[model samples]
Target: MRGDTEWGSIPGLVRYASERYADAEAVVEGRTRITYAELGARVERSTAACMADGVRPGDRVAIWAPNTLDWIVAALGAVSAGAVLVPLNTRFKGAEASDVLRRSGARTLFVTGTFLGTSYVASLRRAMAAGGGLDALRVVVLADDAPADFRTWKDFLAEGEGVGQARVRRRWESVAGEWPSDLVYTSGTTGRPKGAVITHAQTLRAYEVWSDLAGLGTGDRYLIVNPFFHTFGYKAGVIACLTRGATMIPQPVFNVDTVLANLAAERVSVLPGPPTLLQSLLDHPARGAHDLSALRLVVTGAAVVPLRLVERLRDELRVATVLTAYGLSEASGIVTMCRRGDDPAVIAATSGRAIPGTEVRVDAPAPGEPGEVLVRGFNVMRGYWQDAAATAGTLTPDGWLRTGDVGVLDAAGNLRVTDRIKDMFIVGGFNAYPAEIEQLLGLHPDVADVAVVGVPDARLGEVGRAYVVRRAGAPLTGEDLMAWARREMANYKVPRSVEFVAELPRNASGKVVKGGLRGTPATG
Candidate 1:
């Protein structure tokens, strides 16, 4: 768990993990339990499939699916074959998903057949039909039943029969630590989603620090509720488990009942997610029925973490370590974290001090004052994918990353995040950028203008509230707008409440003054 020097690349780590923890359990899904050796063999088969399907080193490969055994294998396999992995948000609607695939120039896609009763292939086809569609994509492998022309998962793996084991090993071995491992697309204040290019070394080193700090060990059973499309789920949940030989039980959704069931059934020992998840579990009336005694470690963040949350877990569930952290995709999804055995007040109030090999500072002149948060460290990403202008704008000449977050750093160097410079909100654990939501809402024919702001919610840390200006004679109601929005974007990105206005307030610079809109009272 040292760093890149210990395991040259992700593939190397996978190989070593497979051998070191070979007999130990790897992934448990329903009745199936895959050992480390078995998981390695599956990843190799998937890597061979990628090779057979013409995926070359540095080629972009996207996966539009949820957290499952297949997702773990497909993603790891693509990276092992030296392909740059691009994971699509499972919550994204067809058009949104297609937009990323088109922009990333992904040559291949591994998608689930149907999830939550939606046919992904059908969804993609409809979205693609409206536009030029994905003409560059040469392969579409479905985890379930195959469509007319698309290949099934079994068939896709079968196609790799011609590829020998030696060739697969060589391809993976050639993947250097410096090579870009994945392009995680994240939306910022600009409303346009950009891919953050992170290397295998950065991911490994950062998560190695994360795993060690959290005391993740070989015998731990982890319940990964975070979406795989997110950095927390893929890197922290999956990658960290690989490093420690922990068993992963991935839950596709955040249903409270399912989580309770898994905690008792799987004897889940490690749970890491946003504050909303832990809150719901704490409040569930049926909590006492389950034997949650096995849970030892709990890591939660991404919103205002209540001091009671840290105390409740320790008092109610008796979890040994409860830590809070803060991160962004630009910094490999980690910048600061509360160490184990830290003062519960410090862990609850701030995201703790910076990890080793990193520095965190605020733009304000004095300590304990709100200012732009900046990070310069080993965890910083190389740059945005193929966007030099954006990269230059974000990264300083001296290598400090301008994290568009307003925070106050204590004299002790603990970072207390105050606000987002981007006006971003977290719906459950998902990040909902207001600008992105506004852009999508602007597409509605009846909407002439829109502004979105994050309002405090009792359950979710915050939810989006949109103020809109309807077109002349449009007769658009908030209900109608919300209905249309539900069809257009991911559920999390859809604003919970909408208000129709004759015109939106604007500053002299002709920008929709969001600060004014943020104070607008609920009209429903």
Candidate 2:
């Protein structure tokens, strides 16, 4: 069955799990625990609802909500109905979400109401209104009290009442392994996000290998703290759990108290996220109050993994398997991962060898030196959706994806990611591109020029510090610039520190000397 191409579709995998796992618990959120069979039924009902709403194969459906049972159902259901899933970041402001929805041409949007005191639906509406409206977009609110203007989740599912199960099944059967299942937007140096299209086969196959390599299996309780929008949470977290029949506990946000409570209450054994997440768990004042003994496997990467953190996770936390993996959105969220029983030092220093069926190469200037990491495998994305030029730039004609990350492959085949070839930084696990922030900062009336660089931080691993050249006699202060940036961009993209400069250092070709900006003390 693993060798068959037809079984690699999202729906196909769900069906297989349902049939095999039967009454086994599949998803757990709050007090709700759904069996694999029950999940299958819900997915089918949701698929019918999507088809009733005229969703067709290749159509894009956007989901803009935090991690919840409904998020999983909506995503899988949309794919089952033959629509491509486009996950919008929960941190995205109105304009950012609007840009993705507009570019993806998502006909349907599944959004949540008030969360953390902010109404996502209202925010999106404001953005759409200002940005010429999303063409032919239908809003579906997933809330207990949905606004009167849009369809509620219950109402949306109720639309399937008149539709037959056979129709839904037909749509499910029509989808094949090669069909595009997801369009995940990744930020680039170009200052605009590009949607990396991935197929059902690619996702299922890659994560099957990921699940196996990570030692995921039935009855393992998985707590997913990563955002559902990113490939890390959706693919490696959710999809991996599904394929392995692990019970998934979806965490909406990364609150230490909530996570610790869930870890104790649910007996979560499988947890994966960036190093910051694990660090927070280890650093929390009340961490030992909760019974975290159930934690056995942990996967972390995306930023430098401190040797101390790896040692503590093993010695202090007593986790049996602490694996570090690496990849980008273009490669289905996993290219290389450490195996269980690997040396703690090796796991800390390098992202393990490439997963089965994937190849990693470093285009080094000198032997064993750090260079751009290139990947070639079934895991590679189909391409940047509708952007041939960007696709051509990133992917070689033969197949290797030119991952802009700089890394070196050791003699043992382990990949140690060094600096980025592109000016992108990770802020608490979120990718923040300097060019995008610089572009937004350049729009300030008092700003004459600006350059952004990643600076080391105690908490977030790396944060952006902007070096700004103000207009002559301008009264712009760093505080004022940051305040403006907070309003204009996502929280992670906003510069944590700002420094005023007489002039930005530039080279002969007139490029901002980002190297010179780093380590410079923040001004104001």
Taking the tens digit of each residue's C-alpha lDDT, what string does model 2 give over 1-524?
26126475899888888788879899998789899999999999999999889998999999999999999999999998889999998888888889889899899999999777788988987887786558578999998677677899999999988889888887888898889999999878878889999999988888888888889999999999999999989988888887878998999989989999999999999999899999999999999899999999999999989899999999998999999999888998888999998998899999999998889999989869989999999899999999999999999999999999999988999999998888889999999899888888999999999999999889999999999999999999999999999888888999999999889988999987788878899987
The lDDT for every candidate, in the order shown, is 0.91, 0.90
TM-score of each: 0.98, 0.98
Regions of model 2 farther than 4 Å from truth: 1-6
Tell me how candidate 2 scores on lDDT.
0.90
Find the 10 residues in a row with the least total lDDT in model 1: 135-144
Report residue 321 deviation for candidate 1 (angstroms): 0.3
Please list the residue runs of candidate 1 whose C-alpha ends up more than 4 Å from where it truly belongs after superposition: none
- Which model scores highest in lDDT? 1
**TM-score for candidate 1:** 0.98
